[model samples]
Target: MSSQPPEPPPPNPTTAHGSDRKLRADARRNRERVLRTAQQLFATEGLGVSLDEIARRAGVGPGTVHRHFPAKEALYLAVATDQIRQLVAEAEALAASSDPAALFTLLSAMMASGAENVAVKSALVAAEFDLRTAAPDVAADLTRHVADLLDRAHAAGTVRSDLTVEEVMALVAGAFAAIRHIGAETSRDRSAHIAQLILDGLRPHPR
Candidate 1:
């Protein structure tokens, strides 16, 4: 025999669907783990953390991260997209509330969520950052969701009618950025306090 190592065994002969399903399930778990790890790292270490580190923390191989998110920007977009979906859903749930003040409450709650609530800003990341350009569909969906929330509030006579959805999103993103920046240097929960102040302005005026 040659000095080379023995050849690997042949592939399994199992049905395609079974293998596909198990592979899909494993992929789903790996994706969730990666996203969760990424979210944690983005919060504690900021967004500059590496994919290898995230995979390690998530108990998966680097390949898994790459398989789910081909680029760092892809990973960032996924994490940010998930966050936006959640905030938009929460905001929509309060759409029919009798108390228009609840709209500001929703804003405060979302703004105080810190890194997780930074999705709106993340969605607006530069065209070079794989946020808007790489995923125009996602960008559109995010814009629509924000518009829905603003429309609901405006119809309820809760928030300012003149304000655009982009403006509101920026305000909330600004709160997330402020807290992240402030909390980076201090031990305080800067978001909660700052969010309250922001809410003061977002609240309805009797006029």
Candidate 2:
């Protein structure tokens, strides 16, 4: 009888694990792409843009968007959380720098990000989804970073002496409201002007 064919080599566990990791990474990248595309479409095109359209713009299958975010509100919350995480990353970078004015830099970034995500913020608020409660860890991380920067600003005499982190946070929130009140959420220059006016109050004034 003809010799039996050689047995196939055993499966390579290393290759299997590598493929698994790559698949996971690709899924994460697709999810992130979906969130960013949804955020842009929501800000510019409004919340009426469907999940399918977002997938099309993000260059992913509609199934990918739905797989990650099953509902509109879910997408809204994810987008909002992603925005704050970005601010937290910026705060981390600012913390690493020697700039005594880093606090102002971070605050400005926060305000600018808020202006860009105002629509998503409003949607979350309407749906009664507070990020502080929904994603407390990320919210706290940003606040903690802000507090650290505020302490630096105090040592360097960059900001008003008595300005607390709570107040700094409040001012950032107020800036968002002011931008919304004046319908400047869609206008970069207008929003930046409003942000400047709010941020000015944090600086030390003449005696």
Candidate 3:
């Protein structure tokens, strides 16, 4: 009898690395959708919105939402982390600018964006968010950068040398608090106007 051809080896599910990779990609996509939907809903409706609603909006199941976030607090933290990242990026971009007025303008804009995002602010409070706590080295770096800019303006007789960096930070914090009290759009407009006024007062008078 003719010898039978050796049978091909059976397919191995465990060897399907490509399949595993596809599964991971799908999971990541679902998680991202959940986060995006949650952020939008939270901004519009506040953090009290239900997880089921978030899942429905995201086109994911409740199970998927839980799997990704575990809890509302965790999701809030994620949102806050994202906002911090954006703020850091803006700061880095503005670091190279030579004009103190322009730098202050950019900083004010960034703060306005933060004030607009309700989820971000909630997350910040939930996380006990401090500039120094959220980003350790970043606080010092930013302070030094701002100080340098202020110094330049001061030397040029455009800004006051008497104001400390701590004082500047206090002013920024007050602006943020004011923005929080008013609606974001209103807050942003008012804050920008107020900031300009503060800057004017801070500017040195020509001899």
Scored by TM-score, the top model is 2
Residue 55 CA displacement from its true place in model 3, Å: 3.4
Give lDDT tens digits, candidate 3, residues 34-67.
8778767777788788888899999999999888
Q: How many backbone collisions does model 2 have?
A: 0
Query: Candidate 3: lDDT of 76?
Result: 75
- Measured with C-alpha atoms, the lDDT of residue 161 in candidate 3 is 65
State the C-alpha lDDT per candidate: 0.69, 0.94, 0.68
TM-score of each: 0.70, 0.94, 0.64
Q: Give per-residue CA lDDT, model 1, range 1-207, as digits (tens).
A: 659889998777677678999999999888988887887777667667888999999999999898888877777777876665665666567655656565576676666554443542443465346445655666566567567667777887877778887787788768777775765313335557787778777766676
Regions of candidate 2 where Cα sits further than 4 Å from its true position: 1-10
lDDT by residue (tens digit), candidate 2, 1-207: 789989999989999999999999999999999999998998889889999999999999999999999999999999989999999999999999999999999999999989988888888899999999999999999999999999999999999999999999998998998999999988999999999998888899988
**TM-score of candidate 2 against the unseen true structure:** 0.94
TM match of model 3 to true structure: 0.64
* Worst ten in a row by lDDT for model 1: 115-124
Off by over 4 Å in 3: 1-36, 97-100, 118-158, 182-188, 191-202, 205-207
